[model samples]
Target chain A: MRTARKPLTAAGLLWGVVILTAVLACSILAGLSTGGGEGGLRELLFPAAGDGDGTRQILLQVRLPRVLLAALIGGALTVAGAVFQALLRNPLADPFVLGVSGGASIGSVLAVLAGIGGTGAGMAFGLDGRMLFAFLGALGALILIEKIATVDGSMSVYTLLLTGAIFNAFSGALIYFLQSIASLEQLHDIVFSLMGHVPSTGFGTVAVLAIGILAAVLYLFLQARDYNAMTLGEEGATQLGVDVERVKRRTFVLGSLLTGLAVSVAGLVGFIGLVVPHMLRLVLGPDHRMLIPCSFLGGASFLVLADLLARTVILPGELPVGVITALVGGPFFLYLLRTRRTGHEFR
Target chain B: MRPALILLAILSAACSNNLQEQKPDPVSPKDGLRLVVVSPSAAEMLAELGMLERIVGIGDFVSRPPGLNRLPRVGPYNAPNIEKVLDLRADILVTVRSEAARASNARLRDLGVEVLELDTSHWEGTRQALRTLGDRLDLGESAGEILASLDEAMTTIRQRAEGSPSPKVLFVVGRDPLYVAGPGSHIDAMIQTAGGTNIAADSDSPYQLVSLETMLQRLPEVIIDTSDNGPDALRGRLPGPWDTWDFLPAVRENRVFWIDPDLLVIPGIRLPAMTERMGRLIHPEIFGDPVEADFEPSPEPGPTETTIEDSP
Candidate 1:
């Protein structure tokens, strides 16, 4: 048992480092290659006065920050997904299964329609009150769903997922009603916000997100052994001396918090959270010790690459980052669903 | 003297009675046609020409020209409520852009309603539509006068700005996918007429998606975003996506201005006023001389000495 554990732990750590390196390299390369062919390797390395030119500035300032933000959000969301799935012992669960994204969207639309985002103080913080309200809404939804899904002093994954779907539908109906009353300008703002364009926020905001996500990941990782045991059914894990309830409560709060933060910042960047954790699981096996950290790095790299393609696919015009993710991830998800029928029930 | 006063009083009474009996009602056209205008601007123009009473129905979106509220709404411009139009027994249906509402227009025509399709998406098109409408409505003289004044305004702006250096302007219509007005759009034409060059005017399409990279390369002197109503849609608000490039003149001088899209984009009688505003925005030095007409002019007296307001 000791010999088996040592290799698994080393392999997990190695893969984690490898993915982090790959993501960093891709982000830098993508930052340089965006804009046009003008920002080649020579321009990236030297950046001469003439060579640095207008195109280089676009690649660095506009595209670079956008790519970095995508990476941070993607990583954060996927890690949250892995944690939620392990906590519930359900492979079908995704980051948005808690209805955080839906709540955030409603709050964003309200902020935009109210015209609060246009105030001077609203603009100074880089993220307008729209984003703040979205975060608060996300937190509210997480708490509401958690309370409803819990019965007889314990949480049920089945109840949680069902309630989440219902809450999402309710939020969608509310958004449509808001759209009907919104002016044309407000409609534009709401549509774009929900469609998930990562507007270039300040580095400070990105750093805050990165720190928040990383802290959550680290906390979850420390509970990795408990997660492994919880996979064997809650009663069985409790019989094995694991404090199942304490683990469940902590994971739910931390996991949902990370998910809410990501959704608030990036809108609903679909598929990454749902698919990345599963894909990492296939490679690293069912161990949360290996799957959780590796999923974060892999997801970040995937999104950074996706965002690069979104910007450069049509020069002088960009496709929304959400479009890029769904276009690629949708087909892959279908393939996974079709080929893999393990029927390994998750909770 | 008493006999003269009694004779004068008897004559005044007879004259006053005759005047009350005549009433001086303005005659309707030879056809006595009842029209329904589906476009808001058309409704406003028709109302301005003393033809509001002739309009038996209007589109639901027609909010301007306050008296129109009492008129029956016939759905939106693109999809007119056919039942309402038919029920009102409208003889003629006025709409903008025949192609925009082809099915609705065809349906109206099929129902024996005369559909007058007007293309008022540009200045010249709007002028032509006005003249055609006037000819059809038998208000040719008023239409001719309105067209003449519009011409006078355009000529004044052209002469003032013809020799001046035109500023390179970027007219952003939307931000997140970054849409700009290209050649053939009314906004593009207005920019050209107002002695400013639209950077996106060279695009093949009427409206094209421009990249932030291209915008930075162009480095326009003025950035005017007619994205929406407020300052958030303006050029300098958070600089969200464009903050990275400090070399942009618009960024450096904070020359980004936001105008109401309705005022700048909608093609109507407001084009002259729109161009004048653009001229002032682009080259304030030359066309800064403000021309203020009483937008609410005193009511003119009709031929028989009745106020135009009282004609109906």
Candidate 2:
């Protein structure tokens, strides 16, 4: 019985990793197909010779960066969502659910309208001021909501969820007010920016984003056992030797960082965070050990596929990937809510 | 003789007092009177007339004309703060005509402010608006000079492209569903004046989507995409849908152009330069000789060049 169980467990882990790898590989292949040229997987994996050819230049410069960025954002958001859901013991938790995304959006909109991103003596580092402001805004929202939701050194699931909802509404109103004051051209930028279209950032920037996401995910995964115990109330987890407060604080900070970094790169890509975690939870069960790792893979694959559809559905013109995720995630979420047999309420 | 001279002096003084007591015309204010101006074009015109110092309040969006940005903003063109205008105790309020600002204009008039509405929707409208503004501000001679110079520049372009064949042009204002300016739009008028036929001119709406099927059928000679604010918009970034129709004359001949929408679409005193640019884009061969340069054309071979193989 022990020998049989050992192989079965090993097979399960291997199969899960294989499935994730397949999804990532497929998405990369599909992304390359949308480039619309003679080049295929060879050109996708390896850069073409420097012949100064226009087609190769477009493929190498534009589509590659966009696809890579989408994958990074998708992976980061999903991992963040998985971590939050585990920490809060709520399946419905997402990066945006805590108001971080909304606050970041407002900050970015303000920066764009004020024309803060351009290089000059006015702003240091020549970074898009909107992106920096968005980071700060996310941090601000996280701290404020954490303070309100935490009572007696313990985070309440109910308060955290409620605060997030109210803050989301407030941020939406703030964005609209900023829009009213924006110029016609600035309005276009703000609208597109909010719709979650990942523009082509350089490979260097993508590398930086990848490193940030990986570090956050690794940190969260290290405390996976603590998250598993927290699923059984904070008092119970503490009795079982889990430092519930420390885990909650660390998770919130790390998760918010991942969220802010993703938003700064890819705007607000909704549904990936909410949908990916739940979908992974259904397969992997409530264990964060498996859930967190699988969520990253699932989210990355889902966004890559969604982005492929976004680019190809209205071919030549692109639909914002956020719209596609909402269309797909909304019904799936409702289905999950409807088919619940257990008495466990989602926070 | 002394009594007669004293009586004449008293009569002359009475006549001068009567002239001072008479109220100025409400519609047209007297020249050299202090007034606050709103609207960037109006502010620019004021500066052009050497009357910037007279402007006490300017619109929020008026950043151009050098010194106007420093002035107190009276709000945007659509909604100028009437309270500020009244508080400044200005003579008149000038504004541009748009559907959104109609109510604001009515309110301004109701508040006893002399409101002059200018329709700066097209080149002709822009010229007429400038002239009307000049008439209102009592800068008639300067307005006449500016209008005459504008007319001369437009006439020069018209004469240059008089007998040349008009190219079929597609002017895209926005992407996604292919929004283009139709008849009754200033862009359409500019395209016509520049010796090109606007393919979207027959659409019902002023700014409407010209179906992709219709676009493919029309096969325009020149495709001018104003979606981007700069020159590189038409190059490799022509989006995806258009790539499928590489056989179209515009694509095959590398006739696609990208120009700043503000310069071409915005109705202002820059119409002359706008028309000249449009003419060059539509028929560069007519204005100047075509030069052989390496252009990164679309990779997909056009339908005209593609061959179908028979299957056994």
Candidate 3:
């Protein structure tokens, strides 16, 4: 079993969390202060007596919810990535790679195809039809993947990986089929929904997402020690008295929940799950306890800043936030691979 | 001397036969030209030209001029079936210019099909396309009459709209992520012709995925929304979704319109009609309020053919 290169000191962990918290706060501030609207940091900082209500509405109602949604989605995907990496003991495992995102996408696309996309009959829990369908799709995918990968009550990581790969391919084909049958208007809606842009939502949506994401992250964090052990392989973790099966199942469910929430709200914002966790792991060692919390804060900061750039890059015209993240993450990920000789640090 | 005379007579007969063969076929009205029209705009134009009978096959998207509904569908404009086009024995395949359909168009052309790639996205393009279609189909007189009517209708609307206050109008094409009809689009042209200022005139492209906050800040006085096409989508003037932004002048004044995209979105021989509908939206006082039929999709089949909406 691989041990931590450096001892886990409380002070070091506390400082990492503190620094990330500060970074996240700064990112949120920057996101709030900047946008395509007339309001800016200067306008926000000094409210003139003649300032129109439009500027205030733009700042509060428009930018705030979007910023909060980005932060929540970013944090959730990043934490989910870190947990999946630990449980699967694979450096490349992410929500997208594990097929959870594909399932949620299928559900969302199906909802859109059913003409329930922006305006349909409201469902239970104040959730829109699309979001509800997406969450259900994620849950269904998680169960299906778990059932298929498990043989004789024991799940093999290799089998799980293969199942995920196959499922994702199937999902992609199915989405294309759905697109082919849709009308021109529906096609446009589907294409835009699939491309990762944070929807302009209300505070109610932000609050719901926050509660769900926080609850899931906390539950996953409690299993951090089991995740750390599982990284040493299933047999090794068993030898260490860890309930490997239980931990794996819990991680998969919780991680998928995080992915579903993010994707349901913000379409498919790629790279946050894959890039942020790996980045945090490289800097903070392969320890799950520190990595989980730090990943949440760091990922939130990264996405908030990415979203800020996405909205501001073209002035009046906005590029999808997914485009910005992938553009930045793809190159950074390649650089990490090239420079990190051995690649054992990830394991 | 008899042999020389016989040779000259044979040479003269041969020359006469050659001249007869080289003479062009006589051009006539409604000359037999088997056309396969894939573009809805082209189909609409052909119907107006009284040449719908010449169309052998229709495309998947051509729902208008219900007389063509009985014809075989050759597939969508971008991915037309080459076999179907050949089987129909089409003399000309009329379609809109699409980058995605380039390969299929090339294959069809190579297989001895005359492809007429028309542009109906703008007013000038529409006029040029109509003229070209007329000349090719030998229906120049019919096409000319349609053009005159279109120009006369447009001139009347423009003249009536003149000296009116140009209300700031927002033409929303999509809501989720907020796509808008910016400057240079057909909608933009209609808004200007209707004497309404386009809120998105400064945007870079004809169709742009715009910033919602920025768009809202512009404070449009009139909002024409054709974004929702779902079966359950609320129709007519209603603040279905725009209720969230009640501060918007459009929402506050109950000027948020939820009309069928077919009424104003599609550019074709319907430009003058579409522009008049737009005038109604921008200046309800002059052009009159948009009636219930304006918010509904064009009725299909049976040839009732409700092309223009009622004036309220």
Q: Per-residue lDDT of B201-311 in model 2, one digit per residue for the tens?
A: 777645553444345456688887765532223333233334445656787777776544544555467677667777777767665532211122224432111211210
Model 3 regions lying over 4 Å from their true place: A1-4, A41-53, A114-117, A120-126, A139-167, A183-188, A336-344, B1-32, B298-312
User: Could you tell me the interface RMSD of model 3?
Assistant: 21.1
Residues A7-29, candidate 2: write the lDDT tens digits. 22546766776888798888877
How far residue A44's Cα lies from its native spot in candidate 1, in Å, is 5.5
lDDT of 2 at B32: 49
Which stretches of model 2 miss by more than 4 angstroms?
A1-10, A35-53, A106-136, A169-195, A312-316, A326-347, B1-37, B45-56, B67-71, B89-93, B96-152, B158-267, B274-312
Better of 1 and 3 by TM-score: 3
How do the candidates score on chain B by TM-score?
A: 0.77, 0.74, 0.86
Cα deviation of A6 in candidate 1 (Å)? 9.6
Sort all candidates by DockQ, best to worst.
3, 1, 2
Candidate 3 or 2, higher lDDT: 3
In model 3 chain A, the worst 10-residue window by lDDT is: A117-126
Error of 3 at B153 (Å): 1.9
Q: How does model 1 do on interface RMSD, in angstroms?
A: 20.2
Clashes of each: 1, 2, 0
- Would candidate 2 be rated incorrect, acceptable, medium or high by CAPRI criteria? incorrect
